[model samples]
Target: MEAGYLFLVGPFAYTKLGKRANADTMDRITIFCFVASYTLALMLELLHSWRGLIAARIGALLSGLAGLVAHTLFLYSKQPPLIWQFSWLLFVAWVLVVAYLTGAIHYRRLTWGIFVLPLVLALVGLAVLFGQPPERGLWTTYETHTLWGPVHATLLLLASVGVCVGFLASIMYLFQAHRLRTKATPGTGLRMLSLEKLEEMNRRAIWAAFPLLSAGMIAGVVLLSRSEVVSWTDPRVLSTVVLWLLFAVVLFLRIASFLRARQVAMLTIVAFLLLLCSLVLSHNQPTGG
Candidate 1:
């Protein structure tokens, strides 16, 4: 009778362990699936850059959409809504990709991925490195789930998208500049816009982003007020102030010959890089506090 009880208990324990292991593996798979999906989508986008194939473009679109769906499910499985810091990052990427996909379908801007995917990858990769809540130590204040949380994240991400535009436009400007100096053809192969258009895009992007970024900062203050864990002088807060000030300089200089066009592009690049740095730095603070 004792032997029978031992055998039954032993099997039950083994089954429980097996289930736990399976659950852990599934969690990892979700991350892998979504990340790989984005990667595949990016590769497709690059491939389209060299050879504009309709099938390839369609494949890229599907891959991006699929990755976004997987990302949603991945977050859902971990928590009903977003509980992880990375989710906020991925959520923004998802929104941006959705917007891109819609624009591609509507205006037929198939080449936009060359500009969009780099920003998407940057956000997603940095988010991955931002670390996750411990397997069991997921604790956050009311602000995380409340209106403040989404409001703060959304406004900031929209602001970041504005920055992303500047970044993409800067890249296009440099390329176009090189082509003009070299007296190269704006080939059908190089599917890019004119320098004037790109600069206009950059100017408008920074203008649109400045106010949103400022609002995001204000929202951050409001959100932080509710949370006792965060301090007034967190590196992220200071970094944001600096970033905002730099934009102010760029805006001011735009009115005069304070800086040349290339100088402004360089500054825009620097500003976006600073934004990226702050996203990573924010993780060093005490999480789950």
Candidate 2:
């Protein structure tokens, strides 16, 4: 009887220990792991541009891929859902990394990583500063897991991504335009999309973002009306509404052909700045759901 009892207990103990070890290993993963990875990738991209080395290019791509894997794993390891500011910022960074990788692979001659990776690092840095859990802990599923909550958050997230893309495109357009105006050559191995292409990209991003922002704001208002915590008059809410209105005006001007490419790019950059303000000022609030 003693041997039989020992055998059953031993297996259970072993299994429990194994599970705990896995959890402990996962817990050891900090944001720095991926931050370092992305930083290395960005440095490698810079090196590739200067030296024109295929190895450096491949290394940068591999580093980005590794970072992406680590980022996904880190996100999966989190106990709470991805509804809060901390997780949301990380998610946004993840999406930007995905965009960078796609562009790097598809437009291998273009230095997409150099432009996009810095923003990824910045987002992660911001996450570190402003995205810590509150004293009461993150908002629980009771508030964040409702039907409208995810919809609202997701729309906003996508819209934010669009804004980021447009910002990058605008910057690239300005850089390329300046180079052309100066009759300067691109960096040794660096290539850029044409001015026209960059302009088109910026326009498309705004077009996509406007509808998403509109839908997100609508969903947000509905979600807020039901919540007792955050009010419509909250700074976060007001700022986001302002952002949407700015996007609307920009989109209309672009469609109406009233604004030149450079003018539109400037407006897009302004929109991105407003978005940064909204994100920085409001991330610490209890508006996660």
Candidate 3:
């Protein structure tokens, strides 16, 4: 349990390092170590569930340490390691943990885990399956004058996370709504938020995320226009434009339904689904991938 807690803490500590100049290497190494540790711990827990062996527990702890050492060695040898990739992984892990811990989701939501884990596994699997390649010369053509690219990416990622929360909220809302409609007592294992509160939370998350997403999309367009490497006609570019339009229309409809909170909540849910679909499509696209 302590080891699992540490595994969770490591990623957040590394994220805080984003503010410092010499923090890149340390942050990357920390994230690599944390993932490796968490994976080991999870494997051990699974084994323990299966075999009920003390040695398996010990193996879990030792594997975690071994992973840390391996990651350290890998980082030491690579020149100017690609830190951002590691950071992204850490951030995603942090969000998942937060979601689980908050009771915003229940343990039975392992099905949700089944949905998200494959994506995370695919990313980590890609990293392990393909060794790091040599760094090419600085692609100045891709660089833009706006310092906003990183900000935009960060905010968009945050907004995406918020949308995920909204998704969960919607699920809970629907579950509770169903119970009310049928006059069924709530089940013991699956606890859900009050319909009113869930709706409030869903609406708030959308309201907060919309502005950040809008800013990110606008800044992204500006940055791409200034960057010679990116073309306006690129499928990736067009997809983003389409996504933004969808979100914008959703936003407009949500605001128009100011008097009807239920309508707003439903619109938020629909918008989040559209955004998620866009993300999946974009990620699967050759240019975006």
Candidate 4:
């Protein structure tokens, strides 16, 4: 049972099984309930795209809220009194879903669902597949116990969510751009955010996310500086540095001149994908000596 308190300080788990953790011990009903809720919500959103129905919007809202509630319950059930196993990347996914839900309610815009739900589904899928309970004989390393760990974690998580929201906005921008360029009529079922608003959101997500991610990477670099347990040469560290630089370029270009909105959107997508890959590499690290 001691092995089960996996993320002592951080929200990551490392083990020898490598590719993905064994998920047999997880709570299936909670998983199923939230997954089904999000899936149904996504479907309703798609239906709105096709039919332009307000009822579909209402259904999607209710479904997203239900999913959010189930997600909270799932986490609560796993988090024993003071023990902090809340470090799963799925927790990031949950935050994104909650943010998406919040955006849906605040904006009252169905198009938000079109671009955001797929990513939410992907994050939830990762949560389902790899968010397993640690086994009795599991090989592991705890990254959360240090003072800097939670700060490192919170910044990275916020950055990731910001990038994700930005990504969705980018998709929206592209959709809006396409319609504008081709003079195509929006389908009766689809209502998109204005190009101006989508562009603004894309810009805001990056402006906010890049600095936080960079700070998180810097904190890790500081940790490596004070010890020899891990190397700066580690793929995770190097890739994040590289990821930070890439976004820095985006941030610079975004602020400097007439960098087209389309280019900025594309860059954000690339940066997010790179971050995802780095996370996958970190997730699969061999923890055994």
Candidate 5:
């Protein structure tokens, strides 16, 4: 669990670099690293299930190094430093890797990579495709001149990453629940987390993410108010509000169903998905400032 959490943190810490580096190269490296590590971890876990801890630890270490190397290469390739988004992205990736490894090895949990990898690829692809040259004029001017602008954006991006975690947790919880209710054994390709753990994770992720997300939204509003070129009606602003509201509802329901763990977990999952949709929409929307 500690490893998984750390892995996720490392990637988000480096998200800003996503747009600064060679996206295709970085994407390939990341995908390769994750798949390699995941495979090794699975093999080790299988050995441990038969041969015991020594074999498992060795496998984990080797896989960890492979993951680290891939991560280091990806980070080093970013020429000019990006705003803190780069660090955050790295932190996020690290955490995901850790989660996948730990879940697979220790708990024999479902292979979350099946769901998560494609999302990572999509994000990287977006960075490669639309992340090119900043638009000229007011928005660009605001971004470059306002020192606080990048900071604000970085905070929002991190918040979005947190929401992504919540989304992942929710999906996992649903799958696990469905498996339990159906009396089906988990497949070899995937390991299902216990319903209790999944629900707990979903709850915790939502609670933690809500505040960070709220801070990001507040920073954005402040930026809009202070900026000369930007307005509250900007698509970014409106979309942020929409995302904020979705998270707010998730939080509200979370508090309301503090006792109903299952319900809270399902709602958290829904809210996170909605949050993701809002982010995609915002990313695609053009900004005129």
Candidate 6:
């Protein structure tokens, strides 16, 4: 009886220890892990573009998928993960990676992966610049739990994703347009969507972004009115307003036919630049007292 009990307990202890070890390994995963994976994927994409190898395309897809899995696990490992600049940027990058993977798989003929992967790498690099969270932490549990807080954050995140989509589409439009104007060959197997489709993508992304951004701003205002910790004169608020105005201007120009597609693409790129600035300069202040 004693021997049997010892055997049972030994197995249980070993299993528990194994789980703990796995958890620790996951927690130990650094941003560089996924960054390197994504970089590898991007390089594979470039290789495919240059050589038109099916093997390179397959390798790129696998690498991207691996990076995404690592990114998800790393995010899950965060202790009581809170929404803030560093984590938010990571989340955005993760979303874009998912989008890239989906598009790459679905539209195998298009060279969107080349354009999108660079942006993903840039976002990850920017997130690294924000570094780790402080011991004291920037946001309290109570702040994030507030009624309007999550709503506002979710909308803004979606809006950011939309802006990124528009930015990419505009870039594709410009490239396709330039290629057409110069009558350049589509660079080996590097096929792109026509200018019309690219323009439509840009327009639809902005159309979706405008309303989401507006709703997010409204929710933010409501949160501000309810919270003593937030103020109207915050730079973040002002920058957000400026960002919205730029979007509005772009929409008006696109709708009014005042600016051609090429000009609209240029303005969309400008908005994208501002969006990057806003993301970089954004502070993770406490949402409520």
What are the RMSDs of all candidates, in order?
A: 10.4, 8.4, 9.2, 6.6, 7.9, 8.9
- Model 1 score (lDDT): 0.68
Order the candidates by lDDT, highest first — what do you get? 2, 6, 4, 1, 5, 3
Give lDDT tens digits, candidate 6, residues 1-289: 2232222122223333234446878887888889989999999999988888889999999999999989977876553223356666677788899999999998897797899999999987877787765443344533364556656766777788888998999999988887888888765446898899999988888899899999988988887777666567766777788888999988887788998988888988887887777766565442111
> What does candidate 3's lDDT look like per residue over 1-289, in tens digits?
2232223223333433235444555445643564566575556645654565567656654654455454443343232222133333334444544443233134332223222333334445544433343332331323212354454556566666666666666666776777788877654323455788878777777767778777767767777767666677865566656656755675677678643655555655676556545444444221121
- Model 3 misplaced stretches (Cα beyond 4 Å): 1-90, 103-146, 187-189, 258-270, 273-289
Candidate 1 residue runs with Cα over 4 Å from true position: 1-29, 75-84, 106-110, 134-150, 222-229, 256-258, 284-289
Residue 148 shift from truth in candidate 6, angstroms: 2.1
What's model 1's TM-score? 0.74
Q: Highest TM-score: which candidate?
A: 2
**TM-score of predicted model 5?**
0.66
**TM of each candidate vs. truth:** 0.74, 0.86, 0.56, 0.82, 0.66, 0.85
Assess the local accuracy of residue 9 in candidate 5 as a C-alpha lDDT between 0 and 100: 32
Candidate 1: give the clashing pairs: none
Candidate 2: misplaced stretches above 4 Å?
1-21, 134-145, 186-189, 286-289
Instruction: Give lDDT per model, in order.
Output: 0.68, 0.78, 0.50, 0.69, 0.56, 0.76
Off by over 4 Å in 5: 1-68, 79-95, 102-110, 132-139, 186-189, 258-270, 282-289
What is candidate 6's CA lDDT for residue 12?
27
Instruction: Estimate, for each residue in 229-258, the C-alpha lDDT of model 4 and write its tens digit.
Output: 667688777777888898889888878975
| Tens-place lDDT digits, model 2, residues 1-289 | 2232222122233333234446777787888999999999999999998888889999999999999988876765553233456666777799899999999999998878999999999988987887555533344533454666666766787888899999999999998888888888665436789899999999899988899999988888888888777777877788888899899888888779999999999999999998878876677653332
Clashes of each: 0, 0, 0, 4, 37, 0
lDDT of 4: 0.69
Least well predicted 10-residue stretch by lDDT in candidate 5: 78-87
Better of 3 and 4 by lDDT: 4
- The list of candidate 4 runs beyond 4 A from truth reads 1-29, 80-87, 133-142, 186-189, 285-289
